[model samples]
Target: MMAMENLKQFLVLLSGAAVFGIVSIVFVLTWVLHFREGLAWDGGAAEFNWHPVLIVSGFIFLQGTAIIIYRLPWTWKCSKLVMKLIHAGLNLLAFVFAIVAMVAVFDFHNGANIPNMYSLHSWLGLTVVVLYGLQLVLGIGMYLIPVTPASWRAAFMPVHVYSGLLLFTSVIAVALMGITEKLIFALQNPKYKDSPPEAAFVNVLGLFLAVFGALILWIATRTSWKRPSDQILHTLHTNGGSEDNTKVSPAMSQLSGGMDAEEAGEVRRRNNKFDDNTN
Candidate 1:
């Protein structure tokens, strides 16, 4: 059991490192390497560059981080309500950045008299953005609004969880497609007939994005990594006194019970199998 716990800790650390590394690579690739002069609204091609930077920073990295916020140890020390607000707030910022990036793309396109939605990347990207917007609205309505019935929230929980993961994956995919399209479009100086240094670097960037996405999913989905019900209640009680030490909602209680049952059953089965083998 000690060894297993150690292994899980190692995996979590490795996953966090991957997330940090990938986002760092994205920053270097966008700001340090490919950045050009006058990258502002009136700067023509430079203005379009914000699209990649913001999408990567906001949609890919921040959104991915938000998805795994529950897995963070520090977050387990805080009230679940506080963590929920942080998670929602991070996602909201990501959505805002994405919207601004979209505006940058359209502004550049119009200014340059270029046609829009001409590439597969653009279509996929636009679709992801629209779905993401819908997701934010539904999520806020279901989870954040005081008027939202607990029963309705409970019913929607599974769908909410599923769609959130789906959108995170889709955002990564769309980002990859966008990166590839941009590389092909921008590096046509030599017509991109062969592998160049810039092409290789950008390809690596895409790979990092893919790796980061996979790592986040791995961290978020691990049953062993979930915050226990006792921890949630303890944290709330410690932070906000007895009056605020509310029991978890039915959905959370059910989830906790389910996880506990699974762990208990697994242990019992292992012990029974061992006794049989010994006999």
Candidate 2:
């Protein structure tokens, strides 16, 4: 069972890594393309236009969600503080995205030239993508980490819930913009009267991926095990999260305080066992 669980962790980590890798490759390719010949809107008012704007915007919004969620500092007796710290640090990559989104929206006129602001926004957007891609990779790492603090279901679920909402909003905004940009761009170009197949494909695929990711995160939030005595001793109680960290028994609290997080787990397990036998 332990081996199987470990395997699951490994595979999840690998999946996250793979996603970031792909994103990196795509970012590099896009940068090259933009540098050499720019995207379809390089010359028009839409140049530095809506599609790129939308993509960057979505990324930024996702970043803000990630920050608020990741900054959660809670290490209960069941989980380690260092791990939480690492997770939080990794999560800050999302902030880069939020910054980009704001830039993308700055002084962006509906149908006129925006070369100066666009240049700045584009540069900032690219930076956000690169940094936030690392956040994705780190998420994969966090998933694989065996010794995560015990506040999993409680500590992070709410964050995930709110973040999911944010992601939905960002994606919707970006998706609409992407579709509209394509329609208008296509309309303007008599050479190609029809909307290209890829616009629909990209927009649809992005939405699908975002939805699927949210579902997976929600599913992951369905586990929590707490010591009974800890609950009895504490007057304040919520689901089970950072706030409950200090409410643990003296031994668990002391050991957690004094020992390294990984070693502290052994002490915590023993204390839990003793508490069970006493009851």
Question: Could you list the CA RMSD of all candidates, in the order they appear?
Answer: 7.7, 12.0
Q: Give Cα distance to truth, residue 65, candidate 2, Å.
A: 11
TM-score of 1: 0.77
**What does candidate 1's lDDT look like per residue over 153-262, in tens digits?**
76776677788899999988988888777767777665445777767767777777778887777766755555544444444455453332332221233211112343
Ten-residue region with minimum lDDT total, candidate 2: 249-258
- Identify the runs in model 2 with alpha carbons over 4 angstroms from their true place: 1-6, 9-17, 20-79, 110-187, 190-193, 204-208, 211-270, 274-279
Q: Can you give the lDDT of residue 37 in candidate 2? A: 36
**Model 2: number of backbone collisions:** 6
lDDT for each candidate structure:
0.68, 0.39
Best by TM-score: 1
Evaluated against the true structure, the overall lDDT of model 1 is 0.68
